[model samples]
Target chain A: DAGITQSPRHKVTETGTPVTLRCHQTENHRYMYWYRQDPGHGLRLIHYSYGVKDTDKGEVSDGYSVSRSKTEDFLLTLESATSSQTSVYFCAISRSGTTNNEQFFGPGTRLTVL
Target chain B: DQQVKQNSPSLSVQEGRISILNCDYTNSMFDYFLWYKKYPAEGPTFLISISSIKDKNEDGRFTVFLNKSAKHLSLHIVPSQPGDSAVYFCAALRAQPSRTGANNLFFGTGTRLTVIP
Candidate 1:
């Protein structure tokens, strides 16, 4: 509802293969984030970008990499996929990091690594 | 180490009854708290949020209570309906902006609420 969309809503791939998920937003928010949801772990932050070409790692940034070349597109790539990387990935955007830090999330990408 | 914790993994309540979901945090610097609801196959949607400055914040049937001294927070849904059944996640973030130029949120494991009709 926040003008966010994630491509490839679902995918299944074998281990050791390269995979990438894309998050696109139309709101032109200043912040973008990538998160993964797993059982018992909830949603863990993978990476986030505050502005174009500015990015940082999150709590669970291991085994993953992200790039933000433009304001609307953020990409999450798993160089060599592993079984542990399989999870529902979500992208979020917010106008700022002040008191009103409410983040709007995209539909999500369900990636399965065999 | 989990900074935020949601001890309950699941909860059940009859429709029209009040449903309470609890969350706890270990960090004292966390000044903001939020609740998110997620339905199956969909991304989480923001439900409510509270700042440490206040003990309670209410919006419609959803109310979030924060106990600073106890490092705890709870969400109350009054007159719950079947549509309320979903996975609820509690998240926390510090008020200050991180040096990395992004403020990240730590989330709880989530509680599945089943509102029986």
Candidate 2:
């Protein structure tokens, strides 16, 4: 409800191919994040960008890369897809500089790598 | 190692009854804690949060309690409803802001709450 949108609501791709997911926000929040959700792991942070051209790895950053060239968009890319990477990906945004800044999430993108 | 942990994988509660969800964390420096609820096929939504400075924070039918000494927290929903059925995640954030720290969050495995009518 925070004006966040994720492209390719659902995607199916084969292994050994490249995949990219897009997250767009209209709220103009200063912070954006990419996360993957698994059955037992819940939602694990993959990467986050605090500002344009500034990004950092999260707990489960392996095999994932992110780019934020503009304020409204953040992209997550998998160089070579694997079945293990199949999961629901979520994009979240938050306004920085506040003690209780809350993160808002998009509907989510379900990716299936076979 | 998981800094934040939610032991229960799923919980079932009867409609109109109180639902209690539990979470634990090992980090002492985490000053802020939050709870997010996610429905099937959707992303998580912010539920409620509590700061380390306070022992309890309440909003509507949802209440969050933080126990810094025990490194634990819990969420209570009064008269739970079927709409409240969803997977809930407990998250913690370090208060300090540094170059290495980007206000990123550490999350738990999440607890699935099912309110049965």
The numbered model that scores best in TM-score is 1
Residues B5-73 of candidate 2: C-alpha lDDT, one tens digit per residue: 999999999999999999999988889999999888888999999989999999999999998999999
TM-score of chain B of each: 0.98, 0.96
Per-residue lDDT for B1-117 in model 1, tens only?
Answer: 889999999999999999999999999989999999999989999999999999999999999999999999999999899999999999998878798657788999999999999
Model 2 — TM-score against the truth? 0.96
lDDT per residue as tens, model 1, A1-114 = 899999999999999999999999998888999999999899999999989889999989999999999999999999999999989999999878675578889999999999
Candidate of highest lDDT: 1
**Top candidate, metric DockQ:** 1
Model 1 clashing residue pairs (backbone): none
